[model samples]
Target chain A: MDGVLKIFKFELHNLSRSKWVILYAVFYFIITYGLFQFESSQSRVVVSLMNTTLLFIPLVSVVFGTMYLYHSREFIELLLSQPIQRTTIFWGLYMGITIPLSLGFVLGVGIPSVAYGMNKLEDVKVLGGLLTMGVFLTSIFVAFAFLLSIRHDDKMKGLGFSILVWFFFGVLYDALILTGSFVFADYPLEKAMLFLNFLNPIDIARTFLLLQLDISALMGYTGAVFSKFFGGWMGMTTALGVLVMWTLVPLLVALRIFRSKDF
Target chain B: MKSVINILLFSCFVLPLHAGEITVHPGDNLAAAITLAHAGDTILIRKGVYSGVGIVINKPLSLVGTGWPIIDGEGKGEIFTVMSDRVSFEGLEIAHAGLSYIKENAAIKVRDVRYCTIRNNRFRDNFFAIYVSNSHHSVIEDNLIFATVKRNTSTSGNGIHVWKSDSIRIVRNDITGHRDGIYFEFVREALISDNRSEDNLRYGLHFMFSDHCRYVRNTFRGNSSGVAVMYSKYVEMTENVFENNWGPASYGIMLKDINDSHIRGNRFANNTIGIFAEGCSRSMIERNDFADNGWALKIMANCDDNKIFKNNFIGNSFDVSTNSTFSYNTFENNYWSNYTGYDLDRDGIGDVPYRPVRLFSWITEHQPASLFLLRSFFVTVLDLAEAMIPVLTPAKLMDARPSMRRIL
Candidate 1:
């Protein structure tokens, strides 16, 4: 446990010094403020931030995290040659990168959102949910990046792969389901569509934020179908649990992958 | 001059006139004609292509055009303006105004008026068809607005644009070949119903920050995107038909940050994606029919606790696509074309819980290209395995209160 703490502190200090985390947070802050100022509607400002943060926070967090892992490859090698076990090093690095950057992420989005929420105290629940969501989602990306970094020492390739994964999960997953549904139009596949939503992490994020916004009606038929099948507390908890899975399962797989990998 | 004599006759009520009548000829000034007209007067333009400037009204007046009178801005100035209470413009064809993205230049502009009506006008080759700003209690219905759509650049013009307006009724208008069919920004308490919107480069209906509005019985067909409603509340969308909106990322209705609304009795068919619901909550979706969509509904997993009940799900390839399970929602009494559950006891409700989502959805959500591995035996086996074991998909995402019979 002492060794794990040492690894954790080392990685945390390394992540804090990286310029990319600061850049990412700064850009996020600018875009959030710009959108808020442009649209005077409070609800709209919150929604845009919610969607943008979900996409950007994860993307930037993963990139910086993966790059950090690659940059410190020689240091990791030296440490591995020393007394530390692989799991301790991996967990330490994961916690180190996630904790500091997660703090930065909160400050970047939370300050403006809190300021906005001051006027609209009714939206405290939404603001809390958004902040919590950003933190967990960032952890997911950070963990995924650490796992990817373990495979390749090349920062560009690792970053590119992370982006591709993000794109597939973020944008293209929904497109494929839609395209396949069209390609096989004759098939009676209503139930299949419900099962298909769990494929993308962004969808899960969207589900939480959208439910909070209270505008699921515009989702039309399938949203209606989902509301029918999973419109209760049990259904919502299950949906949220799936979101946690989107974060945890990948991290776990990445952890396991890192555990067996040779430096 | 004969025009001056006619103007005097028009003002003196010597010529035959009803309600309020003013005539605009090439030789006469439109502003002068408007100045002579009183409250509840009709400004009639003769059958000639006149290239005079815009006409502004400050009273309850009707601007009637006879024989498709053409109003050209002459490339030097603005086209027209209606700035009074209960102002109406009809039966005129307007074209050729300078495009100004900053200053909204329209063929007809209605500003800061109450109870104004703009109908039965044909807009061709104009920067903006009908632009209403800071106006209220107005009706813009049954106008044909066609603007040039370019694939090269984005234009800020719309067929019918309403901004910061309230209690406006827009209905039965055929808007096509424009940047947007109908657009509302920061508008409230309006009703947009029974409009046939088609073949626009952008969304059929694009409105943001507009609240307490109702879009009912409108056919949003064959646009780049059917309709996009973002960041609003208490909006009722019922009995609208969303069809034939196809693209790489197209949907019948794209809703973002909408809350506490009613989406009922709508028909979604033959769109790339029927309805894309993101970041919405506590909405009541009931009695809508989903048929032949590429994907019926794309529910992003963050959405929760919204009731989806009594809807007919027919022939969609993938009914509900999300990254989460159906845990925090209630899906009951919905008729799924793919529901294989049996009503064992002769009651209308199904005997067992129906899992609307399949294991295939979970696989595709994580590994999208695995979609190319579609129809393989591995997909089926994996799906069956997951269904039997229930590992990755949420355990409680099933519909325990499944109805045996179709509600609709």
Candidate 2:
């Protein structure tokens, strides 16, 4: 545990000096500020920012995580020569990447929303949900990226696969679900649709955030089953638990793969 | 002129002699005094609480109270029932009338009476405040009606209810906390103006099967379903403000199966749906302002020949949504805030046409759960793609001449 903490602190210190992290935070702030200035309605601002987070956050996390792991191959090999456990190295790296990214999201979007008079209790809940989902997505995608880096020796192939995974989860999965619903129009596909929604992390985050917004447009949809399940505390907890699973499963797989891999 | 003055003096002296007056105190029986009074007489009640139930007035007389004498029914039955013509009731605080599912009980019930005036009265904690049935030429004005108990749909009644009555004028009244603030059924040629009706469980103002009615300058807010004008013809609704009527099935004004009406200069704000029209035709809907509503105008496909022009649609979630592809109603020269077309000729009209309906609205119409996907990037992309190729949505539903600026 002491080794893990030291490794974590060391990695965090190194990340704090990186220019890309600062640039990412600055970019997030500019876009969120732009969204707030462009639209006066808070719900519209939330929805727009959520879209940006869902698309860009995963893309950046995956690509950056893979690139960082590949570029630090020599440093990682040097660390392997030390008396450090593999789990400590893995968790330390995971926390180092996720915390900074999560902080970037919070400082970027969360601060502006609070500054613009979103301090009401309900608004805080919505902001918290958005930030939490962003962090979870960051963690999951980073872990997946680390896993890919550990499994592959070629840097280009690892980076390409990471981008492909982000595209599949972020955009293509929803398109496939929509097509499946249309093709199976004659059958009762509500259960199947909900099950498919759970398969994608982006959809889970979107549904959870949408349920928090509780706008009439979204509530008026004919899918009562989804709303009925997701509109309560029990459903919210379950969805959040699933997100936790999504974060843990990839990290655990990456840890296993890293422990057995030969330098 | 000399003979007319002499005759007016003679009639004034004789009218006082024929029209007598009776004074009833708090302890005195109001019913007994009312029975002793003749037609064209005045019964004056002092300022005190009078406990009574079902005080029936069978003669033409004026029931005047000084300093707003209270008439408490003690939850028995209707308070005052006017069964004669030329009756006037004023300056009374009537309360606690009974609730009966079998009988339509009210604080005041005027039946088969003509030329009666019910004014300057305060009614509280009653099932129905003032019910005018089978009466004509009645004036219900300047009254304050409120309900204390929160009743549901089965138990609550309207504030001012007019049924089978004609030429009734309901003006300058403040009503709240009833099922409906004002209701008219099978009544014709009525005028409803300058009334403030708010916080009702159902519609603020409801009219059904009534023709040639004019509603002007009324403010209705915070009702369950807002105002509904149905099955009426030759109606004129002007200068009314419908606001804050919000719910899943709420709207500012719902017009169903109506024809040949004029709805002009109305302000509809912050409602779930601004105007919902179904099976309405031959109506002129012009100069109305719709702002911050969920859907500005939901015109069903069955509505035809209605001209909607010069209206401002601002900040509504969906401007105009419909169920079918065929639109016979005309939408021309309306200023839509969502309109993106440019005006190169500078004629105050956009060169390109604007379509109010979106492909996402059509999809949500079928699958309501898809509303969660609203304002998503994928949906925006889908909308732009659908606009490029008009395949699924109604092709002809376009405003050919969209206004460049808002038409106030």
Candidate 3:
């Protein structure tokens, strides 16, 4: 535990000192500020932020995470030489990357929105949900980066695979879902839609955005589905659980991979 | 006892000689006074709580209250049953006609009468506030009706309900918490204006089989559903505000099986669907503003020959969603907020026709659960691609002359 903390603290210090992290924060701040300039309504701003963050966060996290691992191969080797536990180093690296990214996001989006002042409780909830979605996307993609790195030893291959995964989630998966819905148009697919959304973190985040931005549109659906998906606590908790699982399952698999990999 | 004897003696002798105003205090026998009073005479009621009067007017009479006297039903029965023509009720707080599934216990029920006037009254906690049935040329105006139901249910009654009536003028009323704010059935030639109906259990204004009606300057907000005009003909709805009527199957105006009507200059906002038209034809829906609704218009496949023009569609989730592959109605000269075409020719109309219906909208209409993919990246790409080349949505549904600015 102490070894993990030490590694985590050191990696965090190093990443915080890096210029890329600062740039990330600045980019997010600009995006959020521009959104506020265009729309004074906090909910609308939050919705736009959800859209931008969903697109950018996954792409940035995956590419950056893979690049960071490949570039720091030597440093990781040096840490491996130490007697520190592999689990400790794994946790340390994970926390180091995730915390800075989340902080950058939270501070960047949070400062402008908090400055705007959330008068409605609903706005505050949506803002919180948006930030949570941002952080979860970061963790999930970073874990995917680890999985890609561990699975592919070559740097170029690892980077290519990272980009491919990002594109697949961003475009192809949703296309397939849309087509699947169309192809199976004759069947009732409400439960299937819910299940499919649970399978993709990006889909889950998009669902979260729609839960607020298009509530009336959602209500235009049948009554039972809306009540089950949005009007009750069960749906929210399930969505949150799926997101947590998306982060955890990847990280755990990456940890298992790290444990047995031969450098 | 002595006062009662003197009143009886006066009623036996003096009442027969002349028809005059009858003044009754709180403790006086209001029923005996009504019996002794002549037709065309006014019963002047003093300020106090009177319950279970069960007053029935069989002749033309006026019940005028001073200082706003209370006529409570005590949750048992209907308050007034006017059976005669030329009857009027004024300046009273009538209340507590309780729930009865059998009899519609209204504060005032004008039945089988003509030329009745129900004005300047406040009604509370009644099953039906003012029920005008089988009447003609009646005027119901300047009244406030409120009920205690938190939401719309069939058990709750309407604020002002008219059935089998004609030439009725319902104006300047504020109603809430009832099943429907105003309801008309089998009525004709009615004018409903300047009413504020909000937070009702059901529709703010619901009419069926009523013809030649004109509704103007009314505000219907936060109801379970908004105004529903159905099976009516030659109706004119102008300058009304339908807002915050949000729920599944809720619409600002649900027009069903109607013909030859004019819906002009209305503002519809924050509704699930601004206009849901089915089996409607020959209607002119013009110069209306639709903002922030789920779907601005859901014109079904069954509708034909309707003209939708000069409307401003702003910030709606979907501009138009229909179950039709072919556009039956004319959509022209509307200003859509999502229109991105350029006007290099400097014409107010866009050089390119704007397609209001998206392929995704059509898809969602076909499969509702697919709406989970709304605003997703892939969906955006699909929409963008579809916009560049129209494939699934109706081809002829495009607005041939899209406005460069809002149609003010």
Best by lDDT: 3
* Candidate 1 local lDDT, B100-134, one digit each (tens): 65676788888887889888888876777788899
Query: Per-residue lDDT for A141-175 in model 2, tens only?
Result: 98888888988889999999999999899877766
lDDT of 1: 0.74
Each candidate's fnat: 0.00, 0.09, 0.64
Which 10-residue span in candidate 2 chain B carries the lowest summed lDDT? B367-376
Pairs of colliding residues, candidate 2? A221-B368, A221-B369, A222-B368, A222-B369, A223-B369
Q: Chain A TM-score for each candidate, in the given order? A: 0.86, 0.96, 0.95
Which candidate wins on TM-score? Answer: 3
Q: After superposition, how far is residue A61 of candidate 2 from its true place, in Å?
A: 2.7
RMSD of each: 20.7, 3.5, 5.4
Span of 10 residues, lowest total lDDT, candidate 1 chain B: B369-378
Shift of residue B405 alpha carbon in model 2, Å: 5.0
Residue-by-residue lDDT tens digits, candidate 1, A1-263: 88879887876676667766676667667776776776544655675677677677777777878877777788878888887788788778788888877877777777776665534656887777777778877887887787677766677888889888777766667556656776766675655765776665565565566555533231333344455545568767777787788778777887787778766
Ranking by lDDT: 3, 2, 1
In terms of docking quality, how is candidate 2 classified? acceptable
Chain B TM-scores of the candidates: 0.88, 0.96, 0.94
TM-score, per-candidate, Cα-based: 0.57, 0.88, 0.90
lDDT tens digits by residue: candidate 3, A178-243: 889889988999888888888889988888767777776777754237445855698888888888
Clashing pairs in 3: B152-B201
